[model samples]
Target: MTSLVAGALLAAPGVAVAADAGAPPQPLVGDLSTWGSPCAAGEGRPFVRAVPNLTARLYGAGDHQPGEASRVSGEFEAWWLDGDGSEERLTFATGMRSDSTPFSWQLPAEIPADTVISWRVRAVDGEVASPWSTEGEGAPCEFVLDRTAPGKPVVTSADYPDNNNWTDGAGVYGTFHVDSPTDDVVSYVYDFQGGPLLRATPSGPEGSADLRYLPPAGGVFMLHVQAQDRAGNLSSPTYYTFRVASGRAPAAHWSLADAAGSRTAAATAGAAARAGIGASFGSPAPSGTALTSTATLDGTGHGFLTPDASVVGAGKTFAAGGWVRPSAVDSVRTIASQDGFGAPEFALGLRQEDGGPVWSFAVNGTRMTGGLPEAGEWAHVLGAYDAETGRARLYVNGRAVGEEEAVTPVAAEGNFQIGRSHGASGYRDRWKGEIGDVRVHDRVVAPAEITRLGSRAAQLRGHWALENAPEGISAEAGGGEPLKLAAGASIFRAGDECDLLDPDCIPGDWPLADEGHLSLDGTAGYAATDKPVVDTDDSFTVSATVRLADNEPAHPMTALSQGGVHGDAFKVRYTPATQSWELVMSHADAPGAAETVVARVEWPDGGQGGGHRLAVVYDDATDRVRLFVDGHADAGGTAEFHDAWESDGGLQVGRGRTADGWGEYLRGAVDQVRVFSGVVPDQDIAGLM
Candidate 1:
């Protein structure tokens, strides 16, 4: 058994932020109409004031009689009137204090907890006194001062195992018992392993919460629960430790559930093995309410397990898998390894060679490469090596990237280590990333099995259903080619107003349109089609569903365009000036000049809206270019080109031309794009719409 050493807890900077209070209060004179004389009502409140802690003050001025000077010659008096008609008076000088001018007073000690105190103010100068200024008729200003908090909540019920440990696959439910002597408990705040604070309002004074960490990845999570009274006083926190086993036990596994730890225990079946941590650790993955979590490792540090037969000795036919989100890849970032540095054994990580990061999997010191994942994104990676077939394969998010032959088995002297490579000499090649659920198996895992356990990222025909994730990809997806995101490109949640344009209109399924849309910010926002879609002669149909955002500086925005302004190239654009939808086709008319034929249709609804179907058809047989809206043709015109338009440039979406000089980048939702080699007949096009 390896000694378990607890690492120091180093709080991550800015991991959590307190909620922001709105703008500061602006001062104003109080209305004295309701009070009938002396004092005037002020801005801010008749507000609630918490006693013995936080407080609210009503500010106002003394109203002078008709014959008196505007400035009353007396002190402002504030009355703290109880609901039962009892009152106490407090006084403060007018305007000499913090610019709020009116009388301010603390809740009197006689005021009980959770009691409401109504108030009114009057001005008194010697024998002269003004009538009280009330908030409403017989309704004085009211404030509540709460000085007490709810009792500490008890962990009434926890569904952890007998030993307070758990494995994946089971659900977790915990109920907190809260009681307040002075006020009703209003809400509960839960913090799991210091990741993020989750708040839940109780139906009444008590409630049960599904305390399970989201995504259900393996790890140790410390649970802290606190109850808040209606008065806003939070109870002392109650804490408990929960150990979640990996969803599935591998030959050996390290869930890395302990956020601040130098030692992590293996969750493999009936195993008590542990690994020693090196250097400082980082906060756990900030995946609030997410289904999964990870631990961060500094590039200069790593964790290593001694020669564990059940894990590293899983032999030649084995599988290693985990989730890694890298911060940078300038140097090699090790995910998991049992092999020596550059020596025979087994290892899976990322290495930058040829100037870009690539998946690096090795068997017997022969390194094989796989496709790289975008930086700062979670990628489920699996490396399977089969000794019998001498085949080694690497997969990212369920998609197979690369495979190689002549793979060897694990070295006999290999000691399993994570975030670092260890050879006969020592450990090197540290990692800098968030890694979670490290699992090693004794059998070569199949691609189907790996895909089943990964995230969903479906790709097809240069179109990706990003919201469904890469896992939802079918065999025929991606046009047999993968989509590569341009540098700095990303997928963001479409605004609430985005049009889904769901073709089937599946009930309750608005689809990915508004959930995950390709985001283009005009500058450096574009994606490369894994494969090129070239125009077939001068006859082709371009179709796309789009929602044009009212982005100012509307100049002209292109949804889809091909190559340059010359040769069978085409562009779909919304012209702000003309309020029309235009399809521009440019063809070489002469050696140095190109003739452009444009088919323009007054946009539906005068082009003042979004979520419209746009398509352009060019047919050589009819010698006409036509535009379609929804399904029917909107406009058509005759145009004869010098020759069949053609260009070698791949089709561009969200922008026209290449990154070197992109034009009219779209600022809206673009989805369901298709390019047919030949002009699609009206019937076929209608069916598609």
Candidate 2:
């Protein structure tokens, strides 16, 4: 890397000399370079991988005359500093003008793992050779060559075990130990889920680092770590998988919102229930998000039952119920219940003798019944128990109805039942009505919060209004299946962000502030769903608010996309050159398939602005894709797309995947993302905005 002037023979590695009266001015060798070095060395030696393509620079020099130019030949010499003065030389001509040019040679092989290299250059003709090049101080120029990769690092956590079982709680922090000290590792690079690689420096020569990280939400997550040596060499990554139990999350929730179903679907990851022949799903529900699920049961002993174990223990505090609308109040009709060997463990529904149905919140045989709910009218009913006070309360439409009973409910540990109950006589009292948003909270609910459970919940709580930390990724309007974290995106406060779903389970450290937006570095970070958000072949809508770090980038950048076999099935990206927002749809999942870019709307700022509400809808019915900006249809952003294929990859926020890995990262903030199963109406999209 070192360079020297030919006129100054006082010091340094590059050879230089002053023109004498007689001979051609000694050719000057300024500096040396290796193909492996990413950057040039200006003042000191450079480090390069071994067996590099080495080159030396020689200045034009006079051959026949000491002060004039003439054709000349040059010799580049290199020697290993550690080896006995053995030298290697290569020869080249400077052509007609004896012009300055680079002379290259293959660096010596068969060298030790760590070696120091030095080189010099000179011009020669006939019987005369130019003085050897050297630094002004007569010091040799040298560079270190290192080719060995660092050893793999070991990742260990004392608090959370390997992916054996779910950790005790969500958001629990674990300090992971990383090191391969003896291998000359200087730092560690790690990331969560597939986020971004963050560097952690070692405390000392041990090359050991302890990284403290916490899971923002529940479900399975992984941490990747690798050792980085001083020479910028990285070892293969060590993957650490961990699980955080959804202890505070609902044990099970049936939205009953399926379009048509004999088998009911659930929002939560586990806790699926089976619908009986007489039970049907996808019925009209009280005004709510389209995600709301409603189920109807024909009174002929029909209902839904989950094949899950009892989630609520006898002595534990819990809340269970849903939205209900009954047909007749004749017999004891149960909306939801858990079985008991003899009588029913508990049931919440409508029951009255001679007149209108009365809302009932019954646990065992003790019923907290009152409040007349007109037949065929929708009502929110809940049965909540607090073990600490040994009290049970029934709520109708956010208000406690009937007297609060201090009853000790027996353990109704059995399959969760819906629309029917196992009374002493037999499996009777099948519900002849509609039930929606059935949920079971395995923890005690404070009376003040019970009121916020139904139609009374906040406007922006997504499907269920569940609270999540900045690190945790919730379903938004998508429902209970929270998205998994990738490389870990952090949260930042955007003036309009909302975080009203402050559930009891959220950790204390999470501040109850404005809604936080996702901050991505346009790298390997994004939020991912466990399964594909939508069947791309079907009509669907994807929307979110985005603010990019820069509106005009050198390349196209994606705000959201889903992966296919070789590329993305669909991409909501900003094309820098066109200054337009485009929705690209792929024809197939394989590589080099025909692609259709239907929507193209140039931003008002001519690619100078980045904040906006963006949405893309693919209506399979018309085979057209529509783009919306700030909830309004974009005339310039509409066109037809063909041969739409279904993508099986999970929904990815802030990035698009290529054949090799993730790319097109959105470098900015994204908030309030929502993916709907079907095309959302124009007015509805605006209303959501």
Candidate 3:
């Protein structure tokens, strides 16, 4: 007989169980209606209700029934079905004896959100199979995993400072802002074209990124920025373009060119003249004869004359009047032609016709040509060709001499030379006659204006000469003493009775002369006087034409000094180690108190032994200390000591203070010694050249 264990059954209730002794129990087979209690047919009976996380169980009868066998084996299976009866296997248990109890099985991991898991169970005891239980349906169970958060960050604002005008060597900065979900920005990257890549921590909340860049050169540069989240999600790249300019503007300065001392041009002449004006005319003048006219030649030969200098025709049109009598009329040429020195070679004052005094101008070398002027005595020539108006006219002595349309209308090269062509090489065509009252205007000059200019020219003659003498001091002495102007001469005499206090006894009669000649030789060295002696302390420049003598020492030699035993006083000396001239300042009373060495200059070997001009200028305003040899700046330095001269000390030249004799006395000729309180620029130096 099969024995069934009555454990807790999670199946439909009210099912009939046949438990007989000594006979095999028949398998229970009936609809879900038959498994109900007898009180209300099957419809009123309680059935298994499938709920979430629950399973159903069914009991089976064994094949050993009554007294046949003690135990019976069986198998059971369970499955789930949908509302349409599509079934999916749930669990299957094999080798289950009749004594087997019910067990629970878990459902699959994944299921539809609202699906009902309806399941039923069946049992087979030996060869007898039990009927299938009714299906059950219940609410479905599901779980949701969500990772989407608040929202993605949005770029709110970006601020990039314009570095377009930034100097090349200056630092630049950039900044930007972004709207982020939280204060947890992960990383940021910046790409620059020239330098290294820049990175920074992404600012949280009001997200911001500040970057600095130092540009190398001038050009357009592109930059970009990218941001990433903790998950390494990178945002779109933002780009910008900027420029780094050249160096910043320099401090304002006003310096004269090297030629400012010689040629004085009007400051208002315009920028063209300012750039082209050289230091000197250097021998032959570029222009033929200096045009002493009040007219301003509008760099284009068309003249803009003013009445102040009798060079009329500021805005006049010419029917024509005036005579250009050359110094000698060997070859008649037009007045408005290029001539005399380089390039444009020579321009004809007149056209190629020799019949009469034509007022036309022609460019000889270049392809520029013009019309002919009227002919009369002294050449009262007038001609006109209207470039914009397309008209031509000619008059001689206020009368129409000829009029015609120009066959080949060409523009003049605009460079007007008085004596020759624009080429100015003194070539084929040249002006020989003397031209007076040469005037031009924007429009053609009337006969009355021409006649008036001619009458004015007759009265105005002679050259405008410079009135004041050139501001300069000669080598000649100016005081009561006879001027000592020789090359190798000394202006002092040595003797005990030589009026040491009188101005007449002083060789140069220097303004600050106190103690006069201490020795016949004008070489400076330590003196034997117990009383503090007076020397040349007055601010003066001692310049000399130095010619190195054969016996001169090449060691540390003093050129000039005032006081102190050895290294004291302001002196110019040479250092053998550096081979450079040094301007040393020392004081005997204050030893090791920081004596200043202002400037040093090295001279080549061949530069010595030759006659050279040496000048030392001490300016108080700029405290500009300078020393020049052979008209060139050899050694120069600046200082702030305005009053370097002591009242009790007399000035000494060519050597320093010596106890026995003039040891470092310059063994060379000394010429011009000039002293001025004003500062001279390079232009003044070049003027002397």
lDDT per model vs. reference: 0.54, 0.66, 0.36
TM-score of each: 0.35, 0.35, 0.23
RMSD of each: 27.7, 27.1, 34.0
Tens digits of per-residue lDDT for model 3, 1-689? 11123222332233222233422333232311111211111222222212223232335354333333333332223233445556544444445443334333443444322243333344544444444443233112111211223234343223334454543432223334434454435566667773567777754445555554544344576666666543344566656576555322211111111132333223121111121221221121111123232111212222211111111121221121224433333344544332223543222245544554344532223323333332211333444433334444544433444444433233332333333333334333444433333333333333453333332111111110111112211122332112212233233322334555676664322211122211112233222212222222322344434333323246555554545543345666655557666666553424353456665455533223434445555543233466665566742544444334442343334465444434565544333334332233434543321
* Candidate 3 error regions (>4 Å): 1-476, 480-540, 550-554, 564-568, 587-594, 602-610, 634-643, 658-662, 686-689
lDDT by residue (tens digit), candidate 1, 82-105: 455555444433333332333344
Candidate 2 per-residue lDDT over residues 450-546, each given as its tens digit = 5556433113312312234445665455455566556646665433244435443433222122345566676766766766867777567888777
**Over 4 Å off in model 2, which ranges?**
1-30, 36-47, 62-73, 81-100, 124-130, 158-163, 168-175, 197-205, 210-216, 247-286, 289-689
Model 2 clashes, total count: 31
Q: Ten-residue segment with the worst summed lDDT in candidate 2?
A: 457-466
